[model samples]
Target chain A: MGGMKKLINEPADVVSEALRGMGAAHPDRLKVDLENRIVYRKDAPRAGKVGLISGGGSGHEPMHGGFVGLGMLDAACAGEVFTSPVPDQMMAATKAVDTGAGVLHIVKNYTGDVMNFEMAAELAAADAGTEVLSVVTDDDVAVQDSLYTAGRRGVGVTVLLEKIVGAAAEEGRPLQEVADLAKRVNDNGRSMGMALTSCTVPAAGKPTFELAENEMELGIGIHGEPGRQRLPLAPAKEIAAMLVDPVLGDLPYQQGDSVIAFVNGMGGTPLLELYLMYNEVQQLLDRAGITVARSLVGNYITSLEMAGCSVTLLKVDDELVRLWDAPVNTPGLRWNA
Target chain B: MGVENFTNWLRDAASTLHENAAYLTELDSAIGDADHGSNMDRGFAAVVAVLDEVSFESVDELMKKAGMTLVSKVGGASGPLYGTFFLRFGTALAGAEITPATVGEALKAGVGGILARGKAELGDKTMYDAWAPALDAYDDAVAGGADLGGALAAAAEAAAKGRDATTPLVARKGRASYLGERSAGHQDPGATSTTLLLESAARTLA
Candidate 1:
């Protein structure tokens, strides 16, 4: 098979070089810890304010690391391509970003991430007396067997949670309140993903997983895992039906219930396709009688350069809607703040 | 285990990771995202660098420093998992010369630390696959009157077998677990590196 195409100069240096690029690009807002592989806001640990930190594997750009700035994560630890960051990096991040107001870790519910973040929180508590609270996001509806596989993969809602919770932290909310808000976002959201093609990790110099040109995987995870079902290629409207049906079915979203509909691209997909998918998604929600309160369409959480998309719908209330509208400044999502 | 021996083992482990990083990444490429080798290599090199700066009066101090270095330097899952193993293991040792009996206790503590942190059981298809059997092998060897070196060697062998065994099992945890049954047919990179760690311990401590 032919090698996968990448925008990077060298596959081996993707993570480190990307950090350098990000540092050079966003000098004022962020600082990259080359040795520790952490990205922290320039003004970190705002005194007596809760610190929010999140991270996961690389390849999903503008995620945990890119979102580190004002009204977002205090620190973002970058792991290798699609792998969870280790404990020490997390510990340092927790310590670095803590300013007597305590620290909160926003972990996506991958097993390694949960485990490593848990260890880091413990170490921070034992060593520095840093009060650390971890709230895990498992908003993906693709996986039903919550008893295993760390429940479900935390998908796009995590991005929304980080923003909402970050604003609360900036407003000096206590750790408990911040954590509670994070959980609310998690509970209100459900996402399902599908992939048309696989992505390549530079270090691997090959595709992480394979999908036939005419075949697509549904209910797929972000790490290029085979989905719940593999079916022949279908029209965008049909694919939208496949993706949105299960999410709606599982959540029992009633008619007139307000929600934030997010149609996310999985890296390789273009805006044209995402917009097309979004239009289809809106129609499906209309048919289901679910009211769309707010809508975001973009590649917020991606699987490298895979040709795919995931639909995340957050059942929103008045408080979350206000939080969502609040001004925020981060590399990935920038608003008035 | 003496400080020098432990440090040397760490150095050797680092070297092995650096050399076989591509191989490890290759395995991950098949079923994972392909950073296992590089992440482990980067983390361990930092660990070796720490060995020179710290003065250790006992095994606990040495292991603690190693864990700290790994946590701080390594960016990926291997760093935290291995770092926790050493930190918890060192805490269990608590400033003593490690005897076979005490080392067994230390290993058990490290394994438990991983379990508590990762929440992965036997069939989770993670680094735990290698670690669980290695601890069991260490216990069995000690009970059979094997010396520390002999027991570690047995443990290392068990770890390798366990690592290979991950190839057929469906991953029930971690990122690979996201693949469900498709995660089978590829050896787990975490388990493979874990076996190397045990091998390093056996060679250095012996």
Candidate 2:
């Protein structure tokens, strides 16, 4: 557990201070509105482009927030740790970024994120008369029981969806088309995670759950919730299999499918371990006869200081591969931009 | 009761939630992401701030503002569920006489909004578990010719009982449902907070 070892000035100011730092760090590509806790592209409301906005809790740093920039999100809303952004913030962001091409809201399928985005869409449409479309991503294989009303969570696939769908939006696609692409990206992807240590929310100032030295939690989410099952710690190869097997089974990626593989680090993990895990993931996919079209391995989406990793596999066509390889300039992820 | 009393209820709920924030969060930590306490505490605090800044002419205005505050300040399923509760509760009280029967009606309206918004049934192990029994108890007490205070007390008691009853049930809604059977042992934090608010209303609203 991190206890009070976090490099923060105060627990309450963590989100605000971090937002300030991001604004300072990315002045060229991003313009962060501190008042509303929104991060926007430096030159936003691009006249004829369909706007893309996605946000959730704040602790999943470099996610919805850091992904805001050219060829990605136009704006991102930041909420409290593990809490969804309120409607007012989202509504404001929706209004600010609408350029008559309308806006597409990429929402995670969590209860809070759904409701907040729902309310914001209503307010933006009713109050501001801005057309907004929303696509909810719920691809976590951990919540396999579709009958469960809470639904599968949005995990690493969210990062991939934002990038791929952002390219479509930047290509001047209409709101409905962009939203459809977002949904398609969601439908073709699946994720599963495990944690070696619990994440401590700075506000909570303690680990969410306790796990002994040899135990690892399986089926964890990015919100700092303890995983569904606890098992003894294993080597990198075995852990990668635990994550990859469910994702492959749920999407049921066939023997000849091509996938954009993502092995995400849960904040506290090192890049070295992430690469090792990615290596294992590649080997598993090779044996399963699934082709890896592209791969991303890093702390892209994360829980705060939870030493873990989640694997996301997106079944992709040529279009998705091109979009994934598109030019993007954001604080957290950028390539050839 | 007048709008002043309703205003005081929000204030009282804020203070109570602030005091029990840690305990409520601990309860959530068991089956949830451990945020209900801070979320509720921040929400009620925002409500209290609104109450400090503006005076309401009717219970509708007061409660609607509080609902919006909670919705804007608290950012989870609780924001929409509880926010709709207060919103419908206040909307039901519009231009109506404030009596035991009307208040009970307003409570029902509010809980109905929660049911509609949350899409949760009686035994889903959510705050609805507490609110379902609380509504029935309030109406039963009101029908038995109880005063406002008496009926509210009965509702508070029923809410407490319902909160306790959530301990052994599997959660079927919200984040807790992700735990499945693992969610059975821990008490629902939303239920506990709902009980606390009802107890506050019982103590102050009358």
| Highest-DockQ candidate | 2
**What tens-digit string does per-residue lDDT give for candidate 1 at A1-337?**
5976778787667888989889889998998898888999988879988999999988788798888988889999998878788777888999998888889999998766877788788879999999998899898887777666657888888988998888888889999999989998888888999999987777777776677779998887787656767899999999999889988887768888899999999998999999999999999999999989889888888898889899988898888888888778878988886
- Over the true interface, candidate 1 deviates by an RMSD, in Å, of 2.6
Docking class of 1: acceptable
- What is the C-alpha local distance difference test score of candidate 2? 0.92
Tens digits of lDDT, candidate 1, B106-170: 99889887777677889788899999889899999999999999999999999999999999988
Q: What DockQ would candidate 2 receive versus the native complex? A: 0.80
Quote the true-contact fraction of every model.
0.57, 0.71
Tell me how many clashing residue pairs each candidate has: 2, 0
List A-chain TM-scores for all predictions.
0.97, 0.98
Measured against the true structure, the TM-scores of the candidates, in listed sequence, are: 0.91, 0.99
Local error of candidate 2 at A176, Å? Answer: 1.1
State each model's CA lDDT, in order.
0.85, 0.92
lDDT of 1 at A39: 96
lDDT of 2 at A180: 86
Measured on C-alpha atoms, candidate 1 has an lDDT of 0.85
Binned by DockQ into CAPRI classes (incorrect, acceptable, medium, high), candidate 2 is medium
